[model samples]
Structure formats: C-alpha cells, structure tokens
Target: MTASLVSEPLDIASIRADFPILQKILPEGQPLVYLDNAATAQKPRAVIDKLVEVFEGYNANANRAAHTLAAMIDLELDAARSKVAALLNARSTDEVIFTPGTTAGLNMLAWGWARKFLKPGDELVISLMEHHANFVPWQQAALATGATLKFFPLTPDGRLDLDRLSETITPQTRLVALTAMSNVLGTINPIAAIAARVREVGAVFVVDGAQSVPHGPVDVQNPDIDFLVFSAHKIYGPTGVGVLYGKESRLRELEPSIFGGNMIRSVRVDGSEWADLPARFEAGTPAIAEAIALGTAIDYVQAIGLDRIAAHERMLTERAYAGLSEIDGLRILGPAVAHRGAILAFTVEGVHPRDLGELLDQQRGIAIRVGHHCAMPLHESLGLASSARASFAVYNTRDEADALVNGVARAVKSLRRKRS
Candidate 1:
C-alpha cells in the first residue's frame, strides 16, 4: 500500500487489520501465537502490498535508467533512504546505504575497514555477547589486516563488564564493533558509555543495531555511533533489504567494498574513482521494491508510536516473566529484571528445548524459538546448549503469555509422568 489503510487516523486496531497474516490459523485448530518475532517480524499488508505495487506497477533497476520505470524505481529508493535517515536522525539521506541485510552491512564495514584503516598489531574490540554476524566479520578482518581482535567479557548478571571494557580500549584500538543489544539475552547495552570509552582510544565505534532498532527508539546521533546496521525484516518490514548508516566524516575515510556500475564516477583503462558517500557503498542494482516496502513499514510504525509499542511490550514481558518464574524447574536467562525489552530466554530442567518447542507447536500452536538464538557465547556462559525463547511484539497479548506458560507446564508434567 502506498498509504496506510486506517479509516480513523492512528488507530492500532485499524492498523493491525492491515496486516493480513495476523489472522491465520495453525494446525492444532488454535489461533497462531507467533513468538519468534526476534528472528523476523511478520510484515503488515501495507508493506506487502507496496512490494507488489512496485514490482507489478513499475519494476526497474535503480540509478542507471533513462526510462520512466527506472526513474520511478529510483524515486522510490530515494524516498526509502530519506525515511531511514529520518528514523536515525541522520544529517542527510545520502548517509544511508541499502544492502542485502545486516550481515551484508557488517561485511561491507569489515571489508572497507580491513582494507583501509587496519594495521598489524592494531586492536579491534567486541563483546563476548555478539551474534556470529558481528563476531565472524571482525575475525576475518583481523586475519586479513594482521590486527588483534579483543573481546570484552560479560558480567554475571548479563551486562557488559564496564571496567574490563575501559581496560580493553587502548591507543592500538582502531575499531570497536559490538551489538547495541544482545539478540539472545535481550539486554539493552549502554551505548553512550561504550561510545565514550571508544572515543578515548581514538577508535570508531560501530553498532550492530539489528535487534535494537526493531524494539525501541534509536537515535544514531544520540548514541554517537560512527556506523550502524540493521535489517528491515526484523523491524516489521520485508526481507532482502537492510540499511547501513555511517557518519559522513567516517564514510569519507572508508574505501568502497564492491566496485561496479553505480559506485563509480569514471573508470579509466587501469583504475577507477569511486562515487561519493552512500553510492560508493551501494554498488549495483538495488532492491527497489523491498526498500519501498520498508518505507511503508516505517510509516506503519510511526502511526502506532514506538513509545507506546515499547511500553505495551514491556507490560507483556513482565507478565510472562512472572508466569514463567513461578513455575518449578525452570530458570530464566539474561537479567530477570523488569522494564527490560521484549525478549525472554529460559531453560527447563530435564527437557530438550527442541522437544519443548515441538510439543508447544503440536499441542497448543504456540510459536517459541529454541536454540542458541545465534548468541552462542551467551548460551555457553549460562552453561546451556539451547534454550526456549518466547519473544513479544505489538500484536502479542497477556492471554498469549498465559497460554505459553500453561503449555510449558503441561509439557513438564507429561515428561515427569513418563519418568515416573
């Protein structure tokens, strides 16, 4: 949809109705309870319809077209960039570059940093609680540049140890790549403090904002984030589209990762000059349709208001945490604290998380994520191979939390009876 379908402006019920898939049924003859929003949120109809509209209405490659459809596509792409820049409080829309997803964005940063600023024995600091996307890229970059990769350890309560963090940054530190929030632990990191420490070492700070931007307010300027990346799919938008936001100063210093059509000014017989700020990073044909759809998603979110959404999610999280904690033989991971973000991770005694997840689906149609949740280091710190997660979103309710607790209790009882 080019515009939202709400009759009265900014009504959440009217807005929720715009999401077609929210009404789907599950195999157990129960209403589907989607708790895996942390992995990827369901798209609203506005986003889906916009994708169709762009593809069927004016499908064309961006930035290279003299044709009408190509111009239309480029216009949509540019509007999407402007929306994203506004979301991040960026100085200019040109600061935002579209990539495949957060993984591609991180790799782009790693590639450019490794090629340009890295030197032998220089240090790059990250946290123990990073997704593999954030962790592996730095490792590869270190290998390629002969830089040392340093990781800050976590505190017992699932927070970053700030003392060690202060100690870790040194004159040798060139870059610090870390997640703004832990995907598995659901811990909202102290970004301002981290950025401050990074400044003392004269290093650029990059945040993997894949999880943070989806859940709460994100101002890149407020965080002093030199560079940040997040995916559209995780934020109630479409897959195959992501954004990389960089400070203009830092971006000017970075080398282009990919060399091709849209990224070039002029290609000589022997060499080439790269394009400016964002276009330099965005190499070839962009995902125009998906980018436009993401802009639609941004509109959808603003209509509902992120502050209200965050508050509602925290309420649901508190109810769920209380329900889960009252049950025996279960332990919550992360900080078992209230006023936390909208994710919950926990392990059950004598039950495999996979089995619990399968049973929850088969018996109650409840969807919960089960596994390391891509933060293996956090799980290892908790001495868990895998844990069950029931994440919250705008559509989730207190009733859904009740059903989840009762479902898990039933599973535990059944397993115990078998043992008896």
Candidate 2:
C-alpha cells in the first residue's frame, strides 16, 4: 500500500509487545530507551521463533540432495529469496543474491565488476556522505585498477549537492556508488535524479541501501539501478545475511569472484561453467537459518506496513528535532527536519561525544551511538571530531524523545560545571 493509504496511526504499545527487549530494565534499574537503530535493530519474537523453527526442523543443505529435509530446505531457501525480491520490488527472484552482509555484497561487486571492467583513466564517482562499506571498496578498486575516484561535495547543510552531479559524472565514469540515505547526516538523497544522470552517462549506478531499505519502500525497476545492497540485521532480522539486487543483465555479465561447490554448473579438471543469476554469485553453503528468518522479518514489516512505520518514525524524528533544538549548546548535523530520516546526529558545545554517550547510558538508561559511526570522512568534512546519534524506529515512543532531551540537558549542565 502507498504512504497516503495508511489510514490509522500505529499502536506502538501493541507493536512493542512483539519485541520482548522493549520491556527490559537496565542493570541500573532504569528502563531501556533504545535509540541506536541505525547501528542495528533488535529482533522481534516472530523472527526469533522463525530461526528456531528453521534450525529445529528440516535443517539441511539446500539445492543438492534428494532427501526430504534437503528438499524442504531448498523450498524454504527459494521462498526466502522470493520474499527478499518482493521487499526490494526487484524484477525477479533471480536478481537477489544473498551475502554475509551489505559489506560483503559491495565487496563482491567491487571485486567482480570493478576488477573486470574498470581500467586506467576511468572515473568512479561517489559522495562525501558514503559509509566506509560503500567507500573503501571503490577506493581500493580505483587504486588497484588505476581509475580515478571523484567525490560529490556536500551542500552547506550536509546534503549531497545535486547540482554537482553533472560535473562529477562524465562519460569516463565507470560506476557511481552512493548511499540512498546517509547514516551519519540522516539526509536522503534523490535516487531518481542521480540514477538518471548515471544512466545518461552509461555508468553503473550502485546504492548502499543499508540505511534506507529498512526505513521505507525501495523500487529498483522504477529507478533503473544496476545494483542495490542492504543488510537484514538493520531491519529487525538476524545478522550475517545481506541482499544484493542487481539487474538481470548486470548479474549475467558479472563474473563470480567467489568460488565453491554450490555455484558451479559442472566442474571438470579444467575451468567450469558457472550457475545462473543468484547462485552464480552466492558461493558455498549460505546462511540458511539466517536467511529464512530474514524472510520472517520482511513479513513482520509488511504486516505492520512500511508506510505506517515511516509515518510513525517521522513523527518520532519531528519530536526529537524539536526537543533537541531547545538545548543551548547542541547543534544538529544534518538538514532541517523535512529532509532527514529518523536519525538525529548532534554535538553539544564543551561536551565530548563519548562522555555524553556514557552519561546518557549510565545515568539515564538511554542507548545512543557515539563516535564517527563508520563515516569518519563525512564527520571530518563537517569539521567534527565525532558526534552522538539517536535514531528511531516504529516501536519508539514520544516520551522517549522527551527523556533524551531531558537527559542531554542535564548531562550538559553537569559537564560544563565540572569544566568550570
């Protein structure tokens, strides 16, 4: 269903019941306020139960045996792939390849495609907002292949300057890799416009959707993306499972950099032919239980409805920005509330982020992320050594936003007094 079609507001209390950890009280006897969703989300009972079900029953290698358990595993594996394909609105199940995580998928692309296609004097365009997962692979690929790596400079407000798109991407550009949303800045990039420019220049467009996929709907066919990658753990699923959605033609052309038993059509003494589409890239025995449980996570989100989840988190972000703006020394890192995700990255004057994070956790039972958050270059570009981030999800409440504001204000007062 569309975003506009979400008729009723989400019942958060009922939703929180699905995740038992929400009821947890910290060792300090304070209730937990989990705001570190961008790092990883806590799993629901549905996902946990799904994992147990998969492991307890029919736990066997998929796609190679005639036994009952093996056949069951094969069917479950196919169903999991189909679920992931539906989540991304990919063209077909063949487009989705399972990897260990988003890092693995992007690394696979870097090794498989960049190594094969990129050459001397070619340009690889990226942005200052990319997480290291998307950044380092291309950077290393350029270093290895003698290609030049160009960056799209950020606007004054920390969003990608789309005006620089034309200047950055040229005919010589072989690939344009960017994050759909910045994990640090919480800025959502314009995918259609950027993808169009990349297409016009005949460059392969790859998206790091690790931050975006869990927040909202992603339609691959509509934007004509060559490849998009995201991790399951970020969306209330198990860790160690990721998805790489590549266009059918792109997957057909990409050489499998990983080699093992399940990926080959026939193995001879000489070189062997590879399997088709996804199996070509997914080498070895995959994460069967994790992948199956990931499908359950997808189902959990769908049942709650992505549009509803987005709206709920948007409300939470609005409350957070409004409350945090009232603090005297605090400065938010990204654009005004309208263009950001549920993340609020900020720094308080005279207060180190690590110190502030400790205060929030130890004294207030608030869980936030501190440090560069895996986007050190972005932080450096913004003239910040580090920052604290509080990201929201569907089950988060408005009261928790108030608690964060109160806790930070109190922490800042105590910290400044100690300095005095």
Candidate 3:
C-alpha cells in the first residue's frame, strides 16, 4: 500500500517480519490477520529478545542490593523510565511512575489523588465513551468521597461534545478525567483544548492515553496534562507493565495510596516517610525484566517512527471503513474516517458480535475484537448491546483488511440464509 501524507513509504513486509507471531499458520493454512490491536498489540522480536536477555543475563532485584547484577538491573530500569519520559516529552524522569497497566495507574490517581482532593458536592467530569478502566475508578472515587460524577455528552458522530464545556465543567469540578482517544469508537479527543478548559476551572486533568499513545505522538508537556496513563502492551511491549506520567508538582502533592517495602524512605513505629516522586508510588518489586523489555519495545517503534505508524494505520482505517460501509446492514459507530483512528466498531443487523467474531476467526483467521470493548456506557448510549470491532496497527496490511470484509460478508450471507 502507498504511504499516507507526511509519512515515508514503509516496507511493510520487512516490518511484519520483526513480529514472529505474524508468521503463524492456521489449521487450514490460513495466515493470521490480527485486528485486535486496540486490546493488546503483538510484540516484536526485538522486545522478545530483550526480555530473554534480561531474564538470563541479569535477573536481580533493583534499587535495594549493592551487587553488580542489582546495579546493572537498576540502570536498565532507570533507562526504561527515561525512554518513556522522552516518548511522552515529560519534563522529568521523576514524574514517570511504573504500574501494572493503565487501569492500575488510573486507580492509583483516583484513590490516591482524587479522593484526597475531592469533597462532598465536588464534581468530577468524564466522557460516556471511556473504557471501564477510566470510568470505574472515578465512579468508585466519587462514591467514596461523596463527590458528584458528571459525564460529557457525545456528538451524533461519537465525538465528545465540548460546546458546553463551561456548563459541563463547572467551578465545583475538582478533576476532569477522560480518554485521549476512545478505545471503542476510535475518536481522538481534543486534549489540549480540554486541558485548557479544565485549567480554567482550576481542576486537575487526567488523560487516559491507553489508546492514543500507542497509535500516535503524545507530548504531555505541550498538552499541559497533569496526569497521563498508558500501557506497555498496547505499544508492542510486554503485558503486566504500564506508565503513569504526572507533573512533578502534582505527583508530590498527593500521597501514595499503595504502601509497602520500597515505597517508604523510613519506617518508624510512629509514622513512615514516603520515598521521592516515582519510588513513592512504586511499592513492591516491579516487573524488572518486563520494564526493561518495554524500553526495547519503545525503541522498536521509534525506529519505525510514530508518524509513519499512524499514517499507515489511517490508510488501513480508510480502506476498512470503505469496505465495511458497503455491507447491507452494517452500522458503524464512530466519527468519519478523517476524524478517527484505526478502530472500527459496528453492529451487523441480524448477527451477534460473537457469532461474527467466531466466523471471522474460524473461517479466515481474521482476529477481530467483539463485544462492548470495555465501554458499556458508550454502547448503551449508542443503543447497541455489543458490536464487532476491527482495530489496526503498524503491522496490519491492506490485504488483511479486505479479508476481514470478505469474511464478514460471507458470515452475514450464511447466517441470514440459515434464519430463512
């Protein structure tokens, strides 16, 4: 396929070779067409090799021991944080904290920071299209703190309706938490504009970058984001590890919620002193090898370039949108192709999402996500119980998208015939 605007021509064949999983052959010799990137991306060989090296070469606990292995592991861990900070254009390495995933990071901020600042009658704003990861934490925080939770309504095309921003985000709103992009709808939110409004109200802005960061560039410093959360696995890194970026001042203001061995500077009988910025939040032993491997994954993506990756995915999205739009009863659930990312969530008239998904996988080895996509509120708002989703990534190809459309058409035809 030709490259998109502002992007260099990508040798997709060479790029696909880096991912070993892409070479898998199905039972009927069908090649796997992975379209579930919105959930978790497939890892590259470089990241895989790095993980093996970390485990075999230096398997030591970091920050506590004085041994050579420990020192080496600590350096690797620091390097990982530095790479992540650079990726997000964070002001300082100290501002970046490691967590299990985006869910853990959001939960940490909600329970630790929001609960601390939120009071009765205070308001917290979120969007209806948020994944449950970003939604439930704030909901529970509001319930616990007696703060009122407000939702920003969606436009007809699934974009956040920020026209009444002042009305939705009142002065009483202590915090505004929303996704940088919808995991279900693929709608990229205007974060900088939203941040400005949240700042106008003198409230904290927390961005769930679980979807956006992996697909495109995210400069936290430029956006004036107070807190940002994203997972490693979504960016072709290892699972079980994520990053949380907070402004240094903001991070220092809130106390750490999770307490344990490494998080404390001093543990006295009377009280305990917390460690500095990042260490304060990282309580237990971190995912040592996984974090280091995540650094390698970042390296892998940066080498290809984020702009090129995004451009490539956008092209694929355009192709997929055109193909899927032709199906007789398929109804897409997002903005136009120009406004959205590579995700396409839609419902077929007479087919259950699971049935469609199973047919795609079983018949053609086309792997697509089906169901609420962890955005039950978004589906409920859209008047859909569930929908099939095809999300693209850097490694996805034009032919794979066509295969998905063809499989869907065949499935719809057969399912309808059986009903008749």
What is candidate 2's lDDT per residue for 1-420, written digit by digit as tens? Answer: 854568578889999999989999999999999999999999999999988998899899878899999999889989999999999889899999999999999999999999899999999988888999999999999999999999987889988888888888889999999999999899999899999999999999999999999998889988889999999999999999989999999988788989998899999997799988779988899998999999999999999988888888998899989999999989999998899999999999999999999999999999999999988889998889899999998889999988999999999999999999
lDDT of 1 by residue, 170-278 (tens): 8888899988878787787888999988888889999999988887778988868899999999989999999999999988887788888989998999999988778
Q: How would you encode candidate 3's per-residue C-alpha lDDT over 369-394 as one tens digit per residue?
A: 99899999889988888999999999
Off by over 4 Å in 3: 1-5
Model 2 deviation from the true structure expressed as Cα RMSD, one decimal place = 1.1
**What is candidate 2's CA lDDT for residue 416?**
90
Candidate 2: clashing pairs of residues: none
Quote each prediction's TM-score.
0.94, 0.98, 0.98
Model 1 spans with C-alpha error above 4 angstroms: 1-15
Candidate 3 whole-model C-alpha lDDT, 0 to 1:
0.91
Maximum-lDDT candidate:
2
